[model samples]
Target: MPVEQAESLLASQFSIQHTYYRQHYPHGRFDIIMQGTKNIGRLYHDWSGDVVQLIDIALLSAYRGAGIGTRLMRAIVTEAARKHMRMQLYVEFDNPVRALYRTLGFAPAGENGIYELMHRDAMPFDEEAWASVRGLNNPFQ
Candidate 1:
């Protein structure tokens, strides 16, 4: 229950997850979310048949509300739109990020125990709409 022990356990869990993904999703992308010189989070996703599966995305506690996750999600949405593929992800029923996903056009598709499956259909990327989801003005508009 000590802080150090908890951190070590988390690191070990992450390592195990990374290894599992590497072996199972050989073609998937596992990206570190960087903020200038710091590694702030990670994103993992891959193609599942014709759908773009967002397997995981997590930010360090310090970076959770900084719009970084929103930006990364917008990029993924754009990519799925470009490929004309639906995007899907599973979120815990109580996760706050579920609101953001809904704002980005994902709808509740089903449920799996404690997780809810959400799906977003392929649509033309709307920069303005995405920006407004985080209450930001589109810089390029």
Candidate 2:
């Protein structure tokens, strides 16, 4: 196939998938991750159920490994803890971000094909930790 045609086909497929997700998870949120004025990545999640589900999160190659993902995950963990809600997400078996999720207290709950489901029970809120992760006194800020 011509390069242009292949690109168009892929783009349309992605659009279809995105639309399907939106319709399936009507309460899900999709946020663009930004740094200053540049778009760095995206975060998609749903908190409408008993469990806070982190559907997807990605950072640009230039923005990875800089603790941005850690901070974001921490924030979500803190909020879920505050609400006493369990958290869950699916990570590809080979995705390095699984380590970060493990560090944030998520453990392998199950598996489906190439994706491993990670779960973290609701935790007690810790103000100091939340503050630090939020850059209150954290160097990453």
Candidate 3:
């Protein structure tokens, strides 16, 4: 694929293959959060249509223990609920953030051992879909 096409495909498109996230790990997915123009905090979701992922809820170390993580997660959940979409994510067994996800209604799907897969039930969207999508205007440009 041409460089421009590939870049356009990644940045503005959503038809991603499922294997891309697991195989690509943080890069193929997390890169969005680090680099997306609208700074949606880069949501990493599966292209498989069965699962949606939220990875690298990353904030600076000094920012830990603050309410920032909670706010970020609540925003993500609100978006999912507004879209009537379910979300899934994994947290390492020893990772400190595991406790945070639990408060947001995410529980273990028990697929990856130490990494727990949690989800929020699908919901109806009143305006969630239109909220952040326009930020990527001219997706192919």
Candidate 4:
């Protein structure tokens, strides 16, 4: 598809999905992912149930592999564990970040077409892991 057509198709698809989501979860959050003063990405999530759905998370090319995404995901993992709720998201089947999700303890629940659905059950927070990521001796501080 041409760039213009692809953009138009994506916009249309997003509009349809956003409308459906708003109908089902009127209070869902659509957040802008920021780095300092720069607008880096967007995160759309629904936080209303026992299983929180991470609708989307995307960062620009310049921000990829910089540990910012890892931190964000770890925080999500911590929060979900704290709440005793599962976390779920879908990623393109060929996405390299699938490894990161696996490292974060997400397992493949299923797949459809080009997307893989992944789930992480609630578990005790890994304080040591979080600490290690932050270069701290303890995470409880």
- Candidate 2 lDDT score at position 89: 94
lDDT of 3: 0.56
lDDT of each: 0.81, 0.81, 0.56, 0.78
Q: Against the hidden true structure, what lDDT does model 2 obtain?
A: 0.81
**Residue-by-residue lDDT tens digits, candidate 4, 17-133:** 778867866777777677766777666777788888888787788988888777777876777787798989999998999999999899999998899999999887675545433
Task: List the candidate 3 regions with Cα displacement exceeding 4 Å.
Answer: 1-50, 123-141
* Candidate 2 structure quality by residue, lDDT tens digits, 65-122: 8887777778778888988999999999999888988888899999999999999999
Give the range where candidate 2 is weakest over 10 consecutive residues by summed lDDT: 132-141
Root-mean-square deviation of candidate 3? 9.5
Clashes of 4: 0
Extract clashing residue pairs from model 2: none
Which of the predicted structures, 1 or 4, would earn the higher TM-score when compared with the native? 1
Total clashes in model 3, counting residue pairs 3 or more apart in sequence or in different chains: 3
- TM-score quality measure for candidate 4: 0.75
C-alpha positional error of residue 85 in candidate 1 after TM-score superposition, expressed in Å: 1.4
Lowest-sum lDDT 10-residue window in model 4? 132-141
TM-score for each candidate, following the candidate numbering: 0.81, 0.81, 0.55, 0.75
Each model's Cα RMSD: 4.7, 4.3, 9.5, 5.2
Give lDDT tens digits, candidate 1, residues 1-141. Answer: 999999999999989999998887777787777776678778888975799889888889998897778887886787678779999999999999999999889999999999999999988787553543343222222
- Candidate 3 lDDT, 1-141, residue by residue in tens: 999999888765444644555576544343333223344333454423534456545544554565645555665666666556688887888987778777766777775866767766675433443344332321112
